[model samples]
Target: MTGIKAPSKRQLNNYLYDRRREKFGRAAIYLDELEKWIFDGTTIPDDENEVFVFSYHVIEAEEPSFRLALSTKKLLNIVCSTDILHIDATYKLIWQGFPVLVLGTTDKNRKFHPLYLGVSTNERQEDFQMILMALKKRFCLYLIT
Candidate 1:
């Protein structure tokens, strides 16, 4: 053999998937470390990365309930400059089959740009309310500079 064999695309995908699982954890329960970090009120934003965790509620119980909202400063600014906020939820995209709530705004052209993403243990009115409350909280805690 004169040349080294190259890994297949599937091999690359599996490698990436394994790496992702390792880095992010295999399940929602595996998120304890990162969750604890954010729950400790330690999330900060800078020039390189814009992701921010604005609001979260972690309830300890037989079946722990976790609700979190995530967004960026730029997205918040975009949300403010636009009208017609769109909010919706979808299920089964993440572990524990939690519903991921989405927030965005519509432009004059009716294009939807994503603003915030949230996850709740259940898709109930209360869950939605908490998520919105979390979104509201962002303004008070984090001011655009």
Candidate 2:
């Protein structure tokens, strides 16, 4: 059996930062493409030099709800420093309630890929489980013991 190798503090932090950057870059590209499609009715070529307009429509749709839901999800910072990996909604609300999940990592100073899952609603067990499964699949032993 392969033993689990714990990354050093620096290594973990670097990994986390790299992962964060990659995710942000991908999201930016996706948003840019989406905007181009919306405005020009054509797909934009994926290039680093591409100057894509970023509009409030992208942020306004998701940011306020996330900030509001954060009050309820109350995801504690397990590691010293933390990062939010992804934020998403699971379903439409019956009432005024909506479910949101935040995935990320934590550590004292430099933690790498610590999984934090949060849900806006009270019944978040399934959401949490899904998050854990997704994390395990992506990070393998980096997440599991």
Candidate 3:
């Protein structure tokens, strides 16, 4: 052993979530880090960091609805070939108060694979339409391939 005392569970929890809750309490700064990683590609593991941010839109409302997409070429190809998609939305009431919409499909062998995720403050039709439009525009190759 290095003679270093391990942090208590409470200490770890405070270090991770409590600090974040405190900082994010002021404003909607939650997506800033994600934006950096997505836009600048500034995170570890060159292989995994090669993420393409097809579209990221945020509405600056009192309660904002934002949409973010992260996907790779290989995943898009798989999605195109699968030709089937499952879209579902789940509300996370505790954090961010936004509903997350997940779009996914299964491979040839019927293995499920998530294609994209979109988060919106409300589960309105327009929000979903916008998300779906973005996906279609970005992955239009599916039509031809």
User: What are the lDDT scores of the predictions, listed in order?
Assistant: 0.74, 0.39, 0.64
Choose 1 or 2, whichever is better by lDDT.
1
User: Each prediction's TM-score against the native?
Assistant: 0.71, 0.23, 0.59
At residue 18, what lDDT does model 3 achieve?
70
Residue lDDT tens for model 1, 29-93? 54576477566543657632378777787777778777888877777767556658889887646
Q: How would you encode candidate 2's per-residue C-alpha lDDT over 22-129 as one tens digit per residue? A: 876632334455444446522222442332221112223454321111111122222223344444455663223545454555355655442343433334455445
TM-score: model 3 vs. ground truth:
0.59
- Model 1 segments beyond 4 Å from truth? 1-28, 40-42
Candidate 2, poorest ten consecutive residues by summed lDDT: 65-74
Please give, for residues 16-109, the per-residue lDDT of candidate 3 as tens digits.
8877878766535566655565566323223432456556666656774566666655555556566688888876422356666777997678
Q: Model 3 scores what on Cα lDDT?
A: 0.64
Residue 131 displacement (Å), model 1: 1.5
Better of 1 and 3 by TM-score: 1
- Candidate 2 has which clashing residue pairs, if any? 79-106, 79-107, 80-107, 80-108, 105-114
Badly placed stretches (over 4 Å) of model 2 are 1-97, 110-122, 140-145
Report the Cα lDDT for residue 123, model 1: 83
